[model samples]
Target: MNDILFRHNRPDRAATFEEYRAEGGFQALQKALADLSPDAVQQTVIDSGLRGRGGAGFPTGKKWSFVPRNLPGPRYLICNCDEMEPGTYKDRVLLERNPYLLVEGMALACYALGVERAFIFIRRGYELAALNLKGAIAQTHKAGFLGSAICGSGFNLELDVHQSAGRYICGEETALMNALEGIRANPRSKPPFPAVKGLWGQPTVVNNVETLSNIPAIVAHGPAWFKALAATPEGAGTKLFCVSGHVQSPLCLELPIGTTLGEIIDTHCNGMRTGSTFKACIPGGASTPYFTKDHWTVPLDFDPVAKAGSRLGTGGIVVFDQSTCMVAATLNLVRFFARESCGWCTPCREGLPFVQHTLERIESGRGDLADIDILREHVHKLNYAFCALAPGAMGPVEGLLRLFEDEVREHITGGKCPVKG
Candidate 1:
């Protein structure tokens, strides 16, 4: 209820550095610099149970710990602001409101990881967010929060923003690293993970914008306090849910991590529009599986959503109404994934388009019963691709086959899209 990230935000414009500092902003960074050790700050995060808000949902501190502290080189930190996911705009909104939060968060993170140089890999379209961050970084440097010997302590950090040329693949960590390195944006092989070797063959740590922004709050309030902010026992801290589509009032709001999908739609969003009744919703972003009425009460946390057969990816809730066609909707999503593919792997490069073609046949009334089987097969096959792109792209198709097979059949057998008619 205490609005951790948006506390200092203003509706008209981004909160200035003075406004953010006035409301106890850099206290966390000061505490870490003056009192807490890097390990201690990391331990607090691990205990708080904060997971990445960047779709994968990995534990934040655990990720930081993977960077070998003994490694004899400059460790790097990357703030992943490449928010290209469809219907997901929480990071952009957060930065537009209070960019200082991220600057402080990144500084704290850099201290914790012993990182001196860091980059904010922002998407190209987010010019305002990028501008706000650059201004915030300058303010922080002027205030002795960044640059060498920050806060009169021995810690040093230099932050820079790298605006991307805009590709969906850049959202992937390794692919992002490649883009930042001025190479083709394709995912690199893991196990020499980023924490082990990254960014010109140095130890690197990449964190999502929302994940890093929550650091100050977690530090200000103890881990237990942060954990208690969630509505469920397992969940920790609040989540920024960006609701879109058929809802009566579509907007982004910060709520407890375990808030129910039904609560978000009916209570927060004021339910579906005037005449539209809830048909189905993408509980997370475009890549997550569809959630039907049965999952209304399911908590929108990582584990709960996963158990319900969908990921709580980026907390981008896209709602659909009764009149919506699942086949057409899925086709639209598949088309996006197909277009955005980096063309590296065969399955993602070739299979996604094939899947799109099959979906087209079904949506256009030329599909056969055998085509249903073909779609199902590709759903499994695409999972074998190099990265998550193909598997994620197939999510809606899998959901369509599982939940809306009847409707798909209607399109096929009826020789036309029933919803369109």
Candidate 2:
């Protein structure tokens, strides 16, 4: 049994209000609300360097500070619960096991951001999570941690849990805001990021499930203590890496961020699956680029992984054993991107299918050298054509061409997949 920060206190069943209270859950909020000023709390988190756990590793406290605190209107603290990144399931686990952790985290964020109303924009697929969070919210309200006049402290705050239609695009904060407003789930252009103009046109502070969950701890443990939790200069605290695909043991383990890919694979994942040699891994989730066996020694931080040709997206470590076909794998992931494209723009809507068709042609043994050129061309053309979706779709394509160029060339030279037939 490994030690987990959030899940450590998880009971046999869902954590009850009494159980969570006994486990020292709401004490941080009480301390934060009572002793520290909102700016002080935000500064503590900023000093701690707690980055967003969602694919984008923006600093959580910094993101919160972007809200115009002095400009008074109805601000919101939105908990982004849309966990649709392929091979990424850690957020779901966090929400599933301990709903109160998220609630407490949200409360801390509300206090830090000075937002009166908060909403938990949960994905439609996460019915159980929604149910659990709703129950937890009710418990919090009853316990005086939520609703107006929390904990006898004159602060007025209210929290509501809303279900989204479960579109991947809705995971984007702006798109989520639009969905919450009872519109179609499509991403809005940024510049007026969610911090400035968000849910119901309020200065909103949006955070991922895991990102919000980190707040209570950061508040409880001072900034210095939080900084000490990290193995690198980047930040503090362990990351919940969702290890999946072609591994002997697939599970989520909270490890220090600077740990190497190979160490994580060998130790946590029990090495690769039997008869399968480690070929490459998507250090983050599917949206990040791939890393070959040679790059395994690199630390799995946002900066180091980027230097090694990948982003540490969501800390979702998906290892691909040698038995997997790189071309087929790209095709599979592209198909997902194409299907989930909100059809808002040309690049993601049209370019994705074109890329998908090109990969399908290659995998079906009907590909030519021109197909490779077209794939590269389409990726270049589609780069940044829409939201991050287009660029994310290009990650595996670009990674495949960089690392597995020979395998792709072999596919064209042999007029068939070398892996099969």
Candidate 3:
């Protein structure tokens, strides 16, 4: 009953094109192409208060407006589908179940942003989802909704799904652009911002898959309707939460944005699993800080979660039971980052391994009070790395330092892991 982006996603399989149409899937695209001016379309999204679902939570409409009007040559729009973050897989679900959502959403965004060439920079591991998107694009083209004169609106467009080299750095916008150009996927410096110079140095707008996917709904339902979908008055629309770990049912459910974390656990997941009790959770994705029981009641939205001390990243909620050691959990995540570092800068290249080593030592009972202080110092140091990767890697570590210092002290005091015991 609860639906929007996932309205047509049946439990057995993905909805067919005909089924999607029956539910008024393409109607939003038709409305935008037929009635609304580009500015009007952008304005609708602005009024709807739709924020990006791909972690940053930036306003989607405002990002579209950043492209200079009628800029010469070709402007580009990229749907960032490189879902490599640990504890995050929401975009893969959307693409797998309803590929048209992304196709239509990207098309709608192209109209608003004057983008003729669009790319879905996807992670290579999502083979099925990528195939589905390719199929969806073909379907739209055959129906005269893609290629030239889309929906008879004279908005000629071409879409492509470009497979990535399977690197975590490609999730970063500038790094993605570099990867698209067949260059090494290193983070680019900001200030020229993609809206000004991107995708072969032309004006471009890059959006997360979920961010672009919200466009069609905003155009179809009106801004007020979109805003009303969120559980909270200030938020807009439902968020697809990818839940995992220690729950009775670890599922990706579309709950109204701002639904309390406790509600997600109790209602959708049916609470914690047998023999396990909730101890902490990564309120958003793996890159977000951990939330202890104190945050169970916190609204799982951007601002509220941020206010509660973590970014609402990717809306991927990974829980840890009381049996889990925060030190060990954080070390695993940091090690992944260490291996994934693009070797772009010294801090990330050198510091992440050090961070991992510190956590490993702490978990192995070799750490002292001095090691704890150094861990805290590394958290601050990594934040200044060349890209968000190292900083994001420190999220769980920061949480351990802040919330589990006592447990860390136990390792030092007992000369062994108390949690392991």
- The prediction achieving the highest lDDT against the true structure is 1
CA RMSD per model (angstroms):
0.7, 1.7, 1.0
Q: Put the candidates in lDDT order, highest first.
A: 1, 3, 2
Q: Please identify model 1 stretches exceeding 4 Å from their true place.
A: none
lDDT of 3 at 296: 80
Between candidates 2 and 3, the lDDT winner = 3
Worst 10 residues of 3 by lDDT: 1-10
Q: Candidate 3: where is the Cα deviation over 4 Å?
A: none
RMSD (CA, Å), candidate 1 to true, equals 0.7
**Candidate with more favorable, higher lDDT: 1 or 3:** 1
Report the poorest 10 consecutive residues by lDDT, candidate 1. 2-11
Cα distance off (Å), candidate 3, residue 182: 0.2
For model 1, residues 26-110, the per-residue Cα lDDT tens digits are: 9999998999999999999999999999999999999999999888979999999999999999999999999999999999889
Q: What TM-score would you give candidate 1 relative to the actual structure?
A: 0.99
Using Cα atoms with residue i matched to residue i, what is each candidate's TM-score against the true structure? 0.99, 0.96, 0.98
Clashes of 2: 0
Q: Please give, for residues 182-266, the per-residue lDDT of candidate 3 as tens digits.
A: 9988989987899999989899898998888887888888999889898887899989999999999998988899999999998
Considering every candidate listed, which one attains the maximal TM-score? 1
- lDDT value for model 1: 0.94
